[model samples]
Target: MNPLHRVGLATARHPWRTIAAWILVLVALGGLAATLGGELRDNWNVPDTRAQHGVDQLREHFPDAGGSSAQVVLHDDARLDAAVVDEVVAELEGSEHVTTVTPRLSEDGDTALLYVRYDVPTTDTDIYGIVDPLWEAAEPAEEAGYQVELGGELPGTATEIEGRGELIGILVALALLVIAFGSVVAAGLPIAVAVGGLVAGSSGVMLLAGLMDVSTSAPTIATMVGLGVGIDYALLIVTRHVARLRAGDTPVEAAARATATAGRSVVGAGLTVLVSLMGLRLAGLPTYDAFGFATAISVVCVMAAALTLVPALCALAGRRLMPRKVRRLDTSSPSGSDYSTTERGSSTTDDTWTARWVATVARKPVAWALVALTVLLALGAPALGMRTWPQDGGSDPKDSTTRAAYDLITDEFGPGANGPITLVADLDEVSPGEVEALHREVADLDEVASSTPVSTSPDGRLAVWDIEPTTSPIDEDTTVFLDELRADVLPDGVEATGYTPILGDISELLQERLWLVVGFVVLVSIVLLTVMFRSIVVPLKAAAMNLLSIAAAYGVLTLVFQHGWGSALLGVDHAIPVSSWVPILMFAVLFGLSMDYEVFLLSAVRDDWLDTGDAKGSVVRGIASTGRVISVAAAIMVAVFLGFATESAVVVKMLGVGLAVAVALDATVVRMILVPATMTLLGKWNWWLPGRSSAARQLDDELDVTPTPTH
Candidate 1:
């Protein structure tokens, strides 16, 4: 008669009504998304950073130079004819929102970069609409035997997800489900629930975009997270329901009981994920906010579907949620009304394998715990070497137009051509002589590749210079150069902003704030876990183990993406610095997800410990009950996350790999070895609370099971 049980019972009793309600909700939301959703735009504003202030100053003071610029790289083996240059300029200048097209030829005149300035910012224009026209306008140059590649705001601003990656991931998940459940119908239930939840979640994001800023990347990231959690949540509830059916409970009774237990854990796990995402907002970037909002909305919908829809569908499917093999073993099962609680965790109960494994670990708690700690620590070693920067368009696939443009420009102008820093000076505070002196000094720096003559505003309130760095945008050398410019070169009134500096500021800011995020999440999460389980040691232990899993995951990310170890297989051809935002974002997300698995396992262990005071025996039985489910659930998540690694975006690819690695290690090493061994070592002390230790032990003393249930 718990709330979860009541909702589950009501849904199961009125299965068709619940199904219809979900259908209506989906259809209405999907239609609204198709009609009212706003487009996604990149919000790279890093508050309180010099780059952000410089951008604001530029936009406010220098109207002509304020607009975002795109590049049209024209390469020719022969001398570039004036006529071809004029034609390309005229073509681009005529496009919508194009304010001007300024062409600069290389010293040899064999290559040129056309700075196509737009009247509006990149976010304000129809990006793809303008891109197609730019391509068409440059077609004449290509026809005249000039190789033209458009970069900057053209393809650089577009965020496209690879549909194939998700498709293949779902197919793989289906295969795994079938193998686990041994029935296509049973396998399909989790898939159906996940897809349904994803649709609702994605649509919700689109609708929210109409109300708030949502990045194009958010929905995809949300989809990736939703799919894994969705299937895992549904799997937990469905498995419990099937077990109830085998115990001679009717469909409604089975659904209610399953929801009472596994559904409660699903809710807890889902809420933990949502709470952790709140840390992203503390990051102080709309990009991070969009990510948090989209993913949080997604998790809510999926959790709701798992709690309500899973029960409704179970009732509709009746005994079909179980495999044919499972049904064959359930003789004289209740048809529609009987209720039974033959055994807790009968749903995920595995064979002698899990029991034996638990026994083996419990027998040598110290050794097993030490071995797991060592493995996690070893895997986490590489994280110490991880370096982060915002992944530039240079990291795109070679076939991409942005990459092509980047290469052509770099080859012609120098590495600095791809990473120009803008110098913004307040004319009201600085005289013309001072401005010229500043430009001259900056141009004379060894790291400065080239500096354009200072462009002063017509009203004489601002002066700007386009200064190119000798190194690439993500280069460590460029970071030092920027630091030197800010600390040693630039005067008080002058500030820096542009492709290189903005990304540099973002990297610097995110890295500085990373500790703040980590501290906030860890502290808050420990409190939540303690409140949820009512044990100080349990939450603290879970936190420590979660850190080990996350650290190990970071190490894998550093090796694969940063060190280029097997990065090519993940589809990123060369080693690139980790994305500036990846570590903070990864910590926030994975910490929550790691805690999710912890809750799944610990919830069961706690429930069993409460029922039986025998700590070691509870650990053994808990593993036997939940080990198979946790392993299978982790397998499903690994497959899903790995699927997203095939995405074209470097950030998405890195996230996919990192999430997959963390879940894999969390389920196997942390859950299997560490949790059981540590819990056994702690024994009755594991349940000790500030004021309830004596009472908890007195409530029950005939206890001995201790493996946490991983529903």
Candidate 2:
């Protein structure tokens, strides 16, 4: 027996032991994670960039003023309040991690900013903690008719979602599962297995956090992936086990066979996901590293749970997992001896609605293929004009302190004050007079609103200045302004880094490296697919189709978020660039997920081909056999991802929406209609692979050699 078969059999034979062991593991890991896991923080390590180099110097020479800073904006159009502003400064100085609070008044005299520097970097500190004191201190000003808001990273920071999205997703999955299986016991088993695996996987990621700089969004993103794939994996296993039991196999026997087939698919899908995510390491960002770790670990743990726990759960549930009409399983039937022939519980007849639909699509392969391609291409066309920027607080809701601060700053001081360029210079290398000359030159530029005089360090080896632009922080003009200044004006010794430069660098880097990432991911995935399915044509076609799916998702994101078409319905009021990291993230995630449907469909199709030797018939049969399960799985994924869409973070919402749209398209149009039509068109060529026997290879060669044929 294969490893998957052995695992399934082992778990099923000792169901209670398996369940107890899984629970023990979950509890132990949960306890350890809660007690010892490292804290989650936002760390964007864009090393070797101009901004990074400049920031490094500031940290070196001007430690007091160098680290991450926030501004406490006290604005009142009515007039000034000195006592209240001084109280705010005094209160800020007492907060934990606060190093120095430098107070400055705007030229308009109606606005005041207490530039509060923290000893720690923004990545390591709790932004809300910093704001808590500011918020409390600002009460006096607010009572005196002044608008008080926390500006900078404090207000715009994307905090972790409080599990509401995951809970909603799970509830939806439960409802759908009940509808799909028509058995509450069956519906709940998949959820149980998925949640158990998720707990273990999340705990593992928590442990991983101790050794790495985990991003705050890592857990939320990981949970999103875990719920979607975990539930889907369990659903596949449960579906197969039900079919096996109805075919008259004993519960234990059925569980083993289900694991061998569906469990194999789970492993393959998880590996593809992992492999695609491995390309994220190529992006060379520490945040991606943490994200990859969290998500990859979730896949591994959930896959293991599906492979092991699902069978045990199935054995425990027994006949109840079967539909109500078929609950009385007869294990004495002769067909029960053979697992391969009992692919699904029911026989597929030409009269069935699903079968008729498959045949209808199969008959006109070219037309269906063209229509599917046209729709996918049209949906993805908007991606070509996508504009990418890093997440900004300025886009937040007006009620948020960050946005309020942004508006107040823009109104009183100018749009440029919201995001000022920080210039750092080594005073030892270039004299203070030269620094002043550079500032004057910069101030005279069209983009410049004003440039502050350089603030030299106590030792006189370093100087830093705040340069305000005339444009808003999120404005494309600000990005252009920064780039032009960097390339033409800023000398080697002088370095510049701030919101605009940092956004420009991240966007430029990700955009430039996007092709390399795509090439590596696609090439590796194709190789893996070829090895698994033993068909060059199948793997190549799958790759192309998955690319289409990803592109379509990008198009939807561009149209909704970037173009601001219907964005207001999603809580965003105006146009904003797609988060720079989101595209690469979507590519890695969607490619693997889309391939899942491909894997399941191809596996079933190849099985029918080996049995009946009729390519067209096999394509139709494959769809008839796997189409319902694929649709249900994709629907679950879509609902789960959409649940995450309710999150307030721009990046999180973008990811949720993109994943949902792509999966919706992939499972419906691409997998059901497009793949079947293409298979029908290709005929026997679909199974063509070199250096292989006519007989099927075992799953992963490890590849399943046994043909899983259905009646």
Candidate 3:
């Protein structure tokens, strides 16, 4: 029996059994949630390539130096009185984590900046723990007649990471559901299913994070996507089932039929999405690996809920779930078709558009294929010259008083007033003269804007230097300059260690791994497609189509976000180097999502082809039948993603908007027009395989052999 048809038969025969099974599953899931707690981390640890070079310079020069520090800004009155400054300084010094506190005046005399040095390590979680106390101190300072503001890495990260933003996300989701479904009850049901999935999925992530060094960012994104998508898929299935019931089909009959059709589509779509997410593991970046695994797990959980829990809910609600009274009023006396009669005849095959379109496609395959290919090529043009950088310059300068103060300092004390690089050099048995020569060599590099003299360790075994780079620390160019220093400028005897060098090494590693990741994703996708379709030609064609979709998305990203062509309208100004990890991440995510719609459309076509033996009719019918569902799913996902884009963080915004655009384009252009056109051109070649002449025939037999319920 086909798995979907079997599900329908089982539900129809044993509705209570299905409901009982899901209830037990829900109980266990809830119990699991109670035992787990949310695990949170604040830092992204984006490897800074310049850290090593800066450490080398510091070690060769200033051995006694500490690592880089962040400045804490204190917002105060316009006058900048001496008492206020002294009071703030004293309060900072008395704080538990404080190592040193220095107060400085803005040139305009409107703000006082406090550079607070913490004794704790930058990587320590304790740094975030100090934020509340720091805020407490600032509050007293403000009461003492200064409008104090605490701004630094710790403060900024703490503020951003404080809550899950679940409430806001849920509220937004509800609003979108109401707009999409036009029923409060209908909108609420999907949210309930999604929340259940999210709760269960989040616990899974937390447990996984404990077992592996996963990126903290993964959970946040996974929950958002999982909840939104879970609700979307569930809504499609539930709505279809309810519509059937309202049309007068018995509750059991409606559930059976809906499960057989929409259930198959959901499973296909979910598997496609899951496979794509798993593809991210190929990127070779541990962070991306973590993201892939976490997201894949969540997707699986969502799929389970959509398949099981949603059906159970439908069975339990029975006919009451549909607004039957309202539906009856909406259907006037003129169209005297009784609900039961209408529903029985409303099988997916009854739609005339599906048959008519299939005939047209069967007649003109070549023309449609050419048109599809041309459209994809046009959309993919911008990706060819796409360039990426590290920093997405969308942060609010005003929000970070430290950044604001840094801006003021740059205006008054020159741009070099920003943090200096810490260079660490390990000395084995090298003489002072050799060390001095190495220092001179480094100091002469044009990229080294300025260098301070070396400071030796207490045992004279390590040396450190305070070297300032001409470019900003976060700038890609500065990392490149640091790379040149490490590879070309470093003397043979000295080994450098610091923030900059580590960042440089990470960048090089990422660059090297890019192709490997892409190859892995493509390889996996091809294999999965082959297994699903049992045909070499179909898999190859699907892979080609996916690549084109991804390339087009990348091209759009380059034009709008990277090139700053429409950045202003998007509320972003800084042209951030696309993060090194984004391309691989996008490839995995977009390919998977695109494949989702592909599978949903193709499954229907495949089914139809088996039943009628008409290739053209099947493709056209499949596209027409699945088109509405895919469009609705894509619309909900786009809205959810676009909501995330409103966040001030540039990376989140980029990811949100980028995914939104890709999903929208794939749903409308690729799935609706391009896919049908291409399929028309391929004809029987679409089912071709290298070694098997009768593969399509075999597939047809397999489809036909599957069990069907006796109506």
The TM-scores, one per candidate, come to 0.95, 0.94, 0.83
User: For candidate 2, lDDT tens digit of each residue in 640-708?
Assistant: 998888777778889999999999999878876888898889998887887766554433333446436
Ranking by TM-score: 1, 2, 3
Q: Model 3: what TM-score?
A: 0.83
Candidate 3: what lDDT? Answer: 0.64
Highest lDDT: give the candidate number.
Answer: 1
The best-first sequence of candidates by lDDT reads 1, 2, 3
What's the lDDT of the predicted structure labeled candidate 2?
0.82
TM-score of candidate 2 on Cα atoms, chains taken together = 0.94
lDDT of 1 by residue, 250-310 (tens): 8898888888888878987887888889888888788889999999989999888999999
Instruction: List candidate 2 segments past 4 Å from native.
Output: 106-109, 125-130, 143-145, 328-351, 428-431, 691-711
Residue 29 CA displacement from its true place in model 3, Å: 4.6
Error of 1 at 687 (Å): 1.3
Steric overlap count per candidate: 12, 9, 46
Task: Mark the regions of model 1 whose C-alpha exceeds 4 Å error after superposition.
Answer: 34-37, 128-130, 329-349, 696-711
What TM-score does structure 1 among the candidates reach? 0.95
- Candidate 1 vs candidate 2: the lDDT winner is 1
